[model samples]
Target: MPQDDPWDAEASQHVARNPGRPKAGFYGAVPEDDEDGRHPSSDEDEEEEFEEIEVVPVRPKLSVAIGGFAALLAVAVALGAQTTGPDARLSYAIVLFGVQLLGLLAWTMALHPPAAGATAAIVALTALAADYLAVTGEPARFLPLIWVALGGFVAAMIGQFIRAEDRQRARDSWRSTLLIVLGAVAYAILLVLVRQPLGAQTILVCCTGAGLALLVARLTDAVFPKPRIAAQVPRGATGVVLGAMLGTLACAMLGSYLVLPFTPAKGAVLGLVAAVAANLIDLAVNFGEAGRRLAGEAPTFWLARHMQGPLGGLALTAAAAYALTHLYLS
Candidate 1:
């Protein structure tokens, strides 16, 4: 059989065939030749489309290492506070301020800065509170706890404000500031209520509960992705609040059983009530902070990180100190 003539087939096809057109091949269509027989326009278009992406700078490894070392040194100083004798107040002040500084440093250096700093501060304060409680072997008081919380709030705010970027400072809006103030007042009221009934023990129970809640919330986040919520609401706020409430209740029950020697059933009831009160305060403050941060108007304050965590720890410290002082006096 004779092979079909390509020229005859091309003549039969009505599609106008240009001699200059590139031939179709098994691979695919080929680029059309320009007047110059080169795809110069394509090359130029490609050049025009090229873009440079901006790379964000991260903190240097050396700087992060130095920050970690400094935090460790601050912890050592805080540990020395336990042996300060009559100068216990001064020592306590040192520990409190040192912890705040360490927190800030951790925030700047750690991969998950906020979590790193918050965890470090919580662990340090909790350990200190436990040691003091163990040494005193007595119930804690209220006034000292209140004072410490106030002092820590003031100190942390000042330190953070000083270090905050000028842009952050300028972005503070009146609405956010008002929210922060209201949150603080609400927290203060809650503290007074809990103190009236539970005394300084409220500090220990609340701090431990909040810490455990944070840990649980972290685990939950790892397991389940967070849902998108309104801008006013922070991600994971609901879960964290719920976790905090349950943790607070459990901690309170355990603490009461061990310290107050209450029956397990009675302790559980008290714990439940106390946890409700604590959760109310925590929920309000967290909601306020979340709104402020989302608005880009968060105050450069320690409480801005999480109102309950550091404040709770400081209150516990005050309670521990009061217990130790009373033990020494009696």
Candidate 2:
């Protein structure tokens, strides 16, 4: 057949008239396997491999350690309060120190960061110092279980104090304070209804006094929170050494309960003096440290450090007072 005129042919004319489309691959079309083999799917495998993560519960060892420590602390305080004979007192103090160290160690391991961990270390050291000093006094056989219970009570009170202060929660409020006082008084009256121990009256008085003091202190803080001082005692070298020496002297004066023949009044005065001296010494260490310009790890510190000398002194004084009262009056 005669070829149509090239430009006049119908299909040729249509192609010339229409605009041309770009090639598929030129427009970013995904290229298929030219060889006809299927590619392996990395995405499919990834989807299949994905999982929902599950979390395992971690039991809190900190709480347990804290509880145990608190039990030991309360026991120590109560035992310290109850025991007086040189031998009995010394033995209890030793045990109290040991338990306190254990508690401090447990707390260090359980909750506090390394920086603050030194608090526990200081407490442990103080306990050791107390124990060492306690050795100068005679040893007696007393109830271990009592000491343990008292220690636990003291620990609980201390822990409670710490918690309350940290959260600024009041363990005792105006209402609670009133309640505690009234409850104590009520309990004292109840003591009459149900005959109790020989010295229940005095015991009641001390318990009530302690409770009231604690409540008052806490409530006062809650009402007017004051800035806290450095945990460690501040002092100059001379001051700290002086304080430590005073601490030592207080220990010796307290140890005198074993040797001294005096009234509780005399012991009380001596104990009071020892306590004051020891506290002055302890405070001086902190004051002295503050005066210096050096910086490093916080000195091992505890409230007990401030307290021990005074406590020991007071105990000795009380013993003396009791002895004198009994001897002269009897």
Best by TM-score: 1
For candidate 1, what is the TM-score?
Answer: 0.36
Listed in order, each prediction's TM-score against the native is 0.36, 0.24
Which candidate number would show the highest lDDT if scored against the true structure? Answer: 1
The regions of model 1 sitting more than 4 angstroms off are: 1-89, 99-200, 225-234, 261-330
Which residue segments of model 2 deviate by more than 4 Å? 1-81, 84-94, 99-261, 291-330
Per residue, candidate 1 scores C-alpha lDDT tens digits across 1-330 of 678766666675645644445465536757667697776467788777874433222223422332233234323433344234433444444454444444433222311222233333543443344334333433323444345444444433443354455325423432333222222222222222222334344333434444445444434434442452333443344445555556656765665555543444443444344334433443454455555555667354452344233333333333332343234212
Model 2 Cα shift for residue 318 (angstroms): 13
TM-score of 2: 0.24
Per-prediction RMSD in angstroms? 15.5, 23.6
lDDT on C-alpha atoms for all candidate structures? 0.40, 0.34
User: How many backbone collisions does model 1 have?
Assistant: 0
Q: For each predicted model, how many residue pairs clash, with residues at least 3 apart or on different chains?
A: 0, 37
